[model samples]
Each structure stands twice: as C-alpha cells, then as structure tokens.
Target: MRTLRKYAGPLSDRRFRLLWAGQGVSTAGDAAMLVALSLALVSSTGSASALGFVLAATAVPRLLLTLVGGVWADRLPRQKVMLAADAVNLVAQVGIGVELLGTVDVGLVAVYAAASGAAAAFFVPASGAIVPSTVAPEHLARANALVALTRQIAMVAGPALATALVVTIGAPWVFFLNAGTFAVSAVTLALLRVPAVAAVRTGFWDELRQGWREFSGRRWFWTNATAHICWNLGRSAYQVLGPLVAVRQLGGELSWGLIAQGAAIGAVGGAVVALHVRPRRPLVVANLALALGAVPLVLLAVAAAPVVIALAAGVMHAGLSVMQVIWQTTVQNHVPEHALSRVLAYDWLGSLALAPLGLALAGPLADRIGLPATLAGAAVLLAGGCLLVLAVPEVRRIGSRPHQDLPTAEE
Candidate 1:
C-alpha cells in the first residue's frame, strides 16, 4: 500500500492528473501513428530509403525550429504553446489520413510529416517546462515517473493496436485515431489552471543566446548532450533498419510490433523502478543503465528470432526509461524555472541535431556495409557514447537531492 500510494501520489493533483491522462492517450496514438506510417511507406514503395526520407523530413524541421520554440515556450504561457502545437498536429494528422486514404503519395506524406515535426518543436520544450508548475517540488520525480509510465504503456499498446488495424482496416484510420487523441490533448491543455510564468522580457536573439549560455555553462549537461547526439545518431540505424529486417527475415509487421511492444514493457518496468529508487549519483546510474541499450542492436545484427529480439529490446528500453526519468527529474530540480524551457530546448537541439542525418544515411549504409555490420557498428557507437559520458566529474558528483543553488557550468 505504501508503494502504491507513493507511485500514485502525483495523481492526487487534479492538474497533473489531467495532463497525465491526456498525454497518455496522445502518446498511445503517436506510437500507433509511427508504426502505421512506417509500414504504409514500406508497403507502398518497398524501400527503406523511402521510409527514411519521410522520417527525415519529419525530423529536419523540428531540428531547425526547436531553439526558437524553446525561446517562445519560456516567453509565452506554456500551456498555450502546447495547445497551439496540438492544433497544428491535429490538422497535420488529419491531412495525412485523408491523403493516405486516397493514395500513397510519398511527397504528400512528407509534407504532413514536416508540419507535425514543426509543431513538435514547440510542444517538446513547453511540455517539459510545464511539469514543474503542475505538482509540488517533492512530487516532481514521482510525477515524471508517472508520466513516463503512461507513455511506455501507450507505446506497448500502440504498436500492437496499429499492427492489428493495419493488417485489417488500413493505416489511414490509425492517423485519424491519432488526430482524435491530439484533440483530447488540446482539450486537457485548455482546462489546466497553471501558474503564469514571470519571464524577463528580452530580445529574441538575446533570449536564445541566454538559453545557450545556460545550456553550455553546465559541464555535466553539455557532456550528456554530446553523448545524446551520438546515441540518437547510432539509434537511428535500428529505427531505419528494424522494419526492413522484420519484413525480410522475420514475419512482417507483427514481428516488428512485438519487438516494439517488448521495449515498451521494459520501459514500463524501468519507470516503476525509478518511482522507488533515488540513487545518490543519479547520472552515473543513468549512464550505466543506458549501456544496456546496445544489447538489442547487437541482437538485431545477428538476425535473432523475433521473440529473442523482443526480449533484448525490452532490456534496452528499461534502461532508457530509467535514464530518461533521472535526466528529466535532475533538470527540473536544478534549472531555474524561468529558463527551464530554453535550457531544455538546447538539450533537444543538441540531442537530435544529427538524427535526421543518421536516418538519411542508414538505408544507404546498410545497403553498402550490410545490415549486420551496420547494426553492430550502431551498437558499438551507442554503448561507447553512453559509457564515455560517465567520465565527466559533474555527472558523477551531482546528488539526487534538490539544490537551492544551481551548480556553476564549470567544474
């Protein structure tokens, strides 16, 4: 009962509960939409290159606009920014569904992807920034855990549901469902009674420069961000290649769905573990756990069976979930509330800057070096990058407890 109450504590806040519920639904839909989009492209063109192009199209715009989004998120009401992002996403999803229902026009799909990605630029920073305002300081970690838990659960359900729907009805309806979920999220954002941010008004370029300073000043933060860039770049190999491997070696969409589901299940476990454990050296523990992410990539390299690959994916995702929870909690606790969104925006930018490049290159690389070698290389890059981040003294020394004074960027 104590454990149950501790995990459920965040839900006691009406505002947080609303936010959680809405995000949960929307995340599930997002997961389903990803599966549907990937499969639709693959089925239509039978080319990993095509899928990668569309995915890169989605990522490039987000990468370009994220810093601007972050600056605005801090300047404006976070919830309002989130609502506008949701609205853009809703429209984009509807357009994608309508287009897919008529014909599989890759160009049209890419356009929609760009629109959704642009909206996500604004949404990500605001969403991260808003959490601090929704719950008490003490409940911050637990709240992050709960939010992650719901997202993992959605990931678990979304792929399975998408696979079934894609096999039966079609991928178009999945997009429609995602649109509905965005509407639900918009409504929840509308209802939230969040405290207004008291930001110091400044020039846009100056504000962006300030965010950069905040992000760059922290040795631990930028070090981790560098590793994240490498991590995302390496992980893109799996995202781009996994579906193709499943189609050729394993059964098809079902196998890929199972692997995705396994990862989500593992992430769920990780989130649960995070709800209970507060390691004294949070980043150290997080970096170590993140090393597990390499396992599934290696498994895929060797052409492991679907069930085996799924289990490996589960292990990897569990570590990712733990790392994510720790990272988010630490940032929220330490960063100034007014500057949080901008700092997080820099984090997003640094982390995902190379992801599109990776996605764009994955198919061609696999075509040249072959899938197994590419997977193994990605596995090495991810594991090595994660472990290397631990060499930073600040990442090792930072305590789990909240600090009244923010640490200087330098050691």
Candidate 2:
C-alpha cells in the first residue's frame, strides 16, 4: 500500500515551497493591514462611518471587476498577473500609509482602498488557478489545508501584533511593512518556473461566456456556489449583529475578542484534520459541515454565556475550514485548468452576491425587528440553504477520488 503524505509533502516541490512561503507572509501582512487600516481611520476621524466607507470602497470595485480580471488571468501567465497585481498593491499600501501619516483624509484612504481592491480582483483568481500547476492533483487538498493553516495562524496573530505596533511605532509603518511583504511575494513569483498554459485566443466577452457555461454545466459546481451565496449572506449577517449581541448580552468587547480567538483556533484545528482525512463525499460532507456554521448564531440569539458562545463559534469556524479546503480541492480537481481562473471568478461573484446586502441590511433590519428575530432568520437561512444544496443529486454523488485535472500537469 502507498503511504499517505502529510501536509508537508507538497512542500517537497521547490517551486511550490517558494510560492507557499511568499503567500504566508503576504497573507499575514494582509490580516495585519485590516486591523491597522481600520484602527487608523477610526482613531483619526473618530467616526465609525469612516470605517464603513473605506471598506465599502474596497469591496465594491473588487466585486465589480472580478470577472474582467478572470479573463486576463486566463489569457496571460497567471504568475505574471499575480506579480503585477502585487506591484499595484504595494503602491496602494504606500499611498495609504503616506496619506495616513500626513492628512488622515477618508477620501484619500478610499482611493487607496479602491486601488488595493482592484489589485485583489486580479490577484485572487490567479492565485486560485496557480495552485494546481504547482503540485500534483493528489496533493491539492494537503496544499490547500496547509495554506489555510498558515492563514488561520495569521488571523490570530496579525491583529494582536498590529495592535501592539500601532501603540508603539504607528499605523503607517504597518502599511509599509505590508507593502514590503508584497514585494517578497512578487520576487517569489518571478522565480517560479511553472510551464505557461497555452493562451486561449477567444475574445474577452466570448471567453467569459465560455467560462460561465463551464461553471454552470457542472451541477455540483453551481449547487455549491449557490450554497456559498446563502452561507455568506447569513454569515455576514451574524458578523454585523453578533458584536451587538456581545456588547449587550455577553461580556462585551473583550469577550467578543476571546470568541474570535476561539474561532481562529478552530479554523487551524479543522485544517489539520482535513490534512489527514479524505472524505468520500467531500461536498456532501462539506455542506453538512457548513450547517454547523449556524450554531453560533443560534446560540447568540438565545443570549448564551460567553464561554458557550465561544465554543459555538469554534465549532462553526471548524466547519467553515473543512468546507473551504474540500471545495478548493474539488474545483482544482474537476475544472479544466485553462478555464479555471475565469470559472473561479464566476464562483467569487456568485459567492458574494448577497454579502453586501446582508451587511448593509443587518443593522437596520435588526433595529426594526429586534436582534433575536434577525439572528433567528439568519440561522434559518444558513441551515436551509445548506440543506437545499445537499438535496441536489450531483452534490450528494460526487466522490473525492483523485483524478488529473486537464492542464494541471506541470503546466
């Protein structure tokens, strides 16, 4: 019998190891940037509204142009596209940092945010599609889990480190550090030697249409994507309302922070488990695991104690981590490699369809209907949407057995 490889097995390939290290540093910087930017804006302006504006500016452009980015990634070398995106991101970070140190204007910050978002629109799709080319199909799941493990660690450590940095050196320096990490990422991309995929010559709109057809044809693909739409909508709702519940019912900011830490821990733990075990019905089990995501929201609605709420959040996040690893592996395994970036763009667009609405409506709707009622509705949507997806025959039947993805071979 062949001995199964651990998560570290993917790192045995020199090219993938370089890419993985760069990604880890960049992701950690990103996590820290989130805290640093939010804190810098809020502290300077002394308004919660500034925070929202900055975030919205980033998210909207990223959402709107994601498909176009997909087209470019498919037509060009994905690694080159990533390098260019990283360069843009580095510039944006420097711009924000300079603006923050000088005037602290929200408008200038919004501009920088928009630039960063545009860069991300291209970077994300390229990154997603590049993985299969980096490692064999057999190691895809392990690669994904290891990446998530790095991100989870960053999610936990980044904010705390940023908090300390902000207190001592200042926020602009954090931005500078973030920019530096992107440079590191770009350098690694330059060194990577993955064979170039044959450029598809179809026109942009036609290419996009072709990608859409591919994304829509797979029943398992569309079902899971739809499930993501519902899950993200509800998850966003909980994010908007959960803090309020924390402040009013639970111990407050500190408790909420602790709860978030618990979720991070669960994320890492879940990735570890996923690294070891290959589920037969990956999507079926992923959807089922996603159902656990609703648990914390339900608990929060009931005015559960801090400890209980934290535990629930941990459970919820573990489920999320499991689903993420399997879902990414499934896509890399099944999708045609040449078209993967465009298909991934569609996946991104679909997954985030209702997210903004969820975030925007949560506070107003909760105030009108009450927190408990709003949370209850969110919980219902979360569970109901997951179950609905699981009912699809393709989603239930797709097995997790390893197979070669077209063009995923050394290219």
Top model by lDDT, which number?
1
Name every residue pair that clashes in candidate 2: none
Q: State the C-alpha lDDT per candidate.
A: 0.89, 0.87
Candidate 1 ranges beyond 4 A from true positions: 38-54, 101-109, 166-171, 237-261, 297-310, 360-377
Pick by TM-score: which candidate is best? 2
The residue-by-residue lDDT of candidate 2 on 1-411, one tens digit each, is 144545578988878898899999999999999999989998999999999999989998899989989989999999999999999999999999999898788898899899999999999999999988898777888888888888888988999999999999999999999999999999999999897888777798899988888888787787788888888888987899988988998878988887887788888788777787689888888888888989898988998888888888888899999889989888887887888899999999886557888898999999999998899899988988899988877777777765533231123
Models 1 onward score TM values of: 0.87, 0.94
Q: Which pairs clash in model 1?
A: 217-409
* Superposed model 2: Cα runs more than 4 Å off: 1-5, 402-411
Residue 91 lDDT, candidate 1, scale 0-100: 96
TM-score of 2: 0.94
For all candidates, the clash counts are: 1, 0
